[model samples]
Target: MPDYKHFPLADTAEGLTEAEIIDWKVKPGDEVTVNQIVVEVETAKAAVELPIPWAGVVTELLVEPGQTVEVGTPILTVDVDPQGAAAVNGSGSAASAVSAETTETAEAAEADADEMKPLVGYGSKTTVAKRRARKSQATPAAPAPEPVQAVTVVAPRPASEQAAPAGYVPLAKPPVRKLAKELGIDLRTVAGSAEGGVITREDVRRAADGTAETASAAPQPVTAEYDPATRERRVPIRGVRKATANAMVGSAFTAPHVTEFLTIDVTPMMELRQKLKGAPQFSGVKLTPLVIAAKAVCLAARRTPDVNAVWDESSGEIVYKDYVHLGIAAATPRGLVVPKVRDADRKSLAELAGDIGELTAVARDGKTPPEAMLNGTFTITNVGVFGVDTGTPIINPGESAILALGAIRDMPWVVDGELAVRKVMQLSLSFDHRVIDGQQGSQFLADVGELLADPAVAITY
Candidate 1:
């Protein structure tokens, strides 16, 4: 007889509540090996591929693609017995007996499976169902008043004037008609380019432009159609975007945030970055300002440990970290994700660059594992890449501080009593005021700025 088992959604390190079934790798009756990736699920953090723990033949797919299932929900069922097929094919009477026994066993097994513990952790707590009181039937509402119809009167026109000329109606696709309508262009007045005198998008655009030019010469009152489709769009927030939103809200309201800004001349850091790019040790590694800033953060955190600590409200204590798990905030197609570089304080500059590169690549590919994002001691968000000057960034949940790197631009600076052009950058530091005081936060920000201003300062620190 075949031994049946169910596979439930496991709790990943991110503590995901639900995930959408992005894909199913196996169908019913397909043989799957132990530890084989059987399905891909899109959780709030990333797309995770789940593997089966035991080899078996897939009996049924409990969930379909595009369905969002709660954690601990059964996703699939499988049969572990491979020799049951041979036994059934051997003898007719024996086969019938085994079939009846298997039916009973399967029914009992399914019932037991319902109470089975989930593969990852404890199952959801059982809730007692309470009977709701029946609501009294409502009385029928009074009939609504009839709406008044408006009538219009117009003088009759001659048939020649009322009717349009034959083939005068503009030939155009539905989209073209809609476009013309939106542009307030009368199709009858515009010329068509197609063989059948059908209007194309280009023709409509040209006509609209001409109309704009004509109107520019002499302004006229124009009436435009309101298109709700173009006015607004609604996207369901469920995955990474949803998680980020929740975390940000929680962090903002729960933590007393204090942000400080500093503008620094980072010419030396930029020069060092370019030099590293050409070095053999830094070959194949992306040497960006963020890498230097991240290293600076680690060094600065060592001097001011409060910036790397977390506030424990339940225990009424501050948890200061001795080591650093530096998180680099990367904006992916899905959403913003911060994957940590483990033991960042211990890694060399080149090692940090490589780790940042790998983490960013995995995040961009939407393949970052949930575990890689947890337990971050500090976070750095490079808003500079987007050309942003500076932003008051929110601290990531459980972390005391977050640093935002701004765009590097050429600006005039007074150097040695003379004005000259130099690379300038802005830094914004946001920290939990409860764990990090204004003095400590300011010191940390100044240290980072100093390191960026003069890379040699990092060696002394």
Candidate 2:
């Protein structure tokens, strides 16, 4: 009579359909409290820690680490009343708990809603439950597993889809089955490299490529010590990396990009930075060229409002904004994330530097929230930190423009008609041609260059 509750996976971010389990904070037999961090999941935007809402003893972890599951799928089971007399008598069945949970899901499905919403919870939900397909590999000699409902990820297609001869079902995961179907590779003909003769996605791909060894349509014992999985390291593209790739691809293909470069002597800006570092007001603030460039972009945007506008395809209009949500492109070990500083134009130089420091630190730790990454009007990516010269940057989809700040090199520049070695940096501005005119783009670049070339010029703006 253990009061067990099957805890389903909840949507961690907006429009998030699925997440990959990174790690579990607790296991079976461990005690947990309400709102205690239970698992780490990698969503499309970031890595997030999810907390359990129900306090209980961890009975079972249904999902394994590195496995991706759609939102609302049950991930863990908790015995809510673990100390109950019936629970202590060891009468509670996890299978019974699953049956009850599945019943609840079936009841919810009978509702009027056609399109299911992801049960929201990482910050805000329960689930749209879909019972996972079971792993249908047969092992007549092996002992039967316990009668607990387990998340089965290995089988998706029925035996009829595998083209096997006379009552044979190929062992393959859902993704592998889909891949095999697309590539027209018969899973029954391909030899599985995985343990228990389970075919992998790579095996199906190799068979399609003609690189896999041809074997008779018969199951064979895996005798070789070498694991084909170890032949190459496969990093699953999930979280930020996957989202960034998709976003960049969309931006690059959808928007007509025009890039303009401007190289300027930042000797004046550097000198001002040094002087400000000594000032009491600027104490503890690490003001770099990028900070000045950000400020310059804000000031310049006032003169060229088109750079801070969005080209709305649905509305067929150019949407102008009075405020700037400046996106600072931060590169973490995971991938590139452009988290925005809300109302960046209104912030002072010192405020901008501090906000960026905290924002980037959170991003580097892979903790930037989904809302922090949205609603950016303009983006500034400091490639200079990587010691890279300027390259054309892609517009951040909805926004019109992006600025790439390059390395600050000590180069010879003509100063007052005299050649002098000074700190010079290049700025590359890429804009959506549909939103920003060539003249406006040039004017914005010139304004930013002028501000960096002479710090006093900001008084006029």
Collision count for each candidate, in order: 0, 2
Candidate 1, residue 401: the lDDT equals 94
- Please provide, for model 2 over 1-461, each residue's C-alpha lDDT reduced to its tens digit, 9 standing for 90 to 100: 24556666676666887777788999899998878888988888888888877777987676667666656656777776665443111334434443444444332321212222333343213553344442333323322233233322122334534443322344565577668867867666778898646788889889999898654554422222544877854555667888888999999999999999999999999999988888776677677787888899999999999999999999899999999999999999879998998999999999998888888999999988777888899999999999998999988878999999999999999988999999999999999999998999999999999999898999998
Q: List ranges where model 1 is wrong by over 4 Å.
A: 85-231
Q: Give the TM-score of candidate 1.
A: 0.72
Q: After superposing candidate 2, which stretches have Cα over 4 Å from the reference?
A: 85-234
Candidate 2: Cα lDDT at 386: 93
Question: Tens digit of lDDT per residue, candidate 1, span 82-129?
Answer: 445533332344434343444344233324334434443333226422
Tell me the RMSD of model 1 versus the true structure: 20.8
lDDT scores for all predictions? 0.75, 0.76
Q: For candidate 2, what is the TM-score?
A: 0.72
In candidate 1, which residue pairs get closer than 3 Å at backbone N, Cα or C atoms, i.e. clash?
A: none
